[model samples]
Target: MQYPIKKNSLVDETIRTIRQHIRQQTWTLNERIPSEAELVELFGIGRNTIREAIKILAYLGVLDVCQGDGTYVRAVDDFSESIVLLNRASLHDHLETRCLLEIEIARFAARRRNAEDIQNLQALLALREKINPLEDLEEFWIRDRDLHLAIAIASHNQALHATYRYFLSTSYEYTKLFIQDEDLAEPDHPAHETLVAAIISGDENQASAYARALLMPTIQQLEQLSTT
Candidate 1:
């Protein structure tokens, strides 16, 4: 039941370790986990860290913490468990998956977008244009994510929108890694303009092609990073 919390990112390390333990079947469904006190001793961490880690697991439906009772493992099938594992995938994998998702989303948006969706996409693009990525990286990153999510929303496929949002949330840290690169300091305004125009024009082929072009540089960079 003892676990060593890594020196870096203690809370995140603890969460990963506990999730691994559950995946390994060291803990079964309905089986109560070690107490907060025990976990404190197990991980050589304070109560707050253990509590926070447990709370996160509970929120993810991996654990059920009952007041006046201990926390129990919740049922998780292979499919559900895979979703949790997706969050742990490498940045390269995340980008690859995102590229595929965006391409399909662009195609769908081109076909199904309405006047309101066009207006929303234009608004986001306008906000994006104001951001100078070199001068304001954080704002640039936020606007970039919002613009892509807006396109996904315009797809009118609720399932695609939901999946895209989930991927954005889970791969956020990795996305930040790419945005911080000096090589990526310049925003691709023309690409964004072209993509939006294509979608608004209902040119699914152009929209999909533009989406791929938009993400291709990031994908290639990640590929190089993986090799080196």
Candidate 2:
């Protein structure tokens, strides 16, 4: 089957179309997905685009690619698989994982942050402050991501920074959904300011505490949501 290519974000559009097909049960669970050549022909895109889309799906556990064999459907729902993953961690587990990484990131950032890192953090915070979460959730999220990534960059530990990004990528959709919940409140801007202050002052303990403070309310809310 042929699919029309859009003018913008071709790879994203392609991925969305393929994901839609899976969700609509165009293909059954455990069924082999169309071959790369077939997908390239179907989507009217290059082989590399098809490969990238397929790789993203496989990474998200929606598809299982076996070399010398073929790619098969692993899950019908991308969002569900994203939050729970194949390992079946609880929602609280996911929140705790984020909390653990971020707290240490704050501490390292406090110890290692340089002048440029501070400037980046301040700029990201300024951008974040201007965003109205109720008005533009997507932009709010993007700024939020930038702010956290700025902190990670301040950490000056390449391995830690990379791991933090990996976790953020996997949890991105879930975090987006959580923030969009009407019952969920916006992030505490004052807490962020305080966290930045601690980092600027090079106070590792205070920075860690502020980071935990920033994350705790959301964690409590998630815990409450899970039970209800």
Q: Which candidate number has the best lDDT?
A: 1
Model 2 C-alpha lDDT per residue in residues 1-228, reported as the tens digit of each score = 588778588778887888888888887899998899988888788898888888998888889999989999998766544544623655567777888999999999999999999999999999999988768877887888889989999999999999888777666666666667767654578889999999999999999999888767878887887789
RMSD to the hidden true structure, all candidates: 5.8, 10.4
Give the total clashing residue pairs for model 1. 0
Q: Write the per-residue lDDT of candidate 1 for residues 73-162, one digit (tens) a residue.
A: 995543455786797787678777888999999999999999999999999999999988768877887888899999999999999999
Misplaced by over 4 Å in model 1 are 1-80, 183-187
lDDT of 2 at 121: 93
For each candidate in the order shown, give its overall lDDT on alpha carbons.
0.85, 0.84
Q: What are the TM-scores, per candidate, against the unseen true structure? A: 0.64, 0.60
Per-prediction backbone clash count: 0, 0
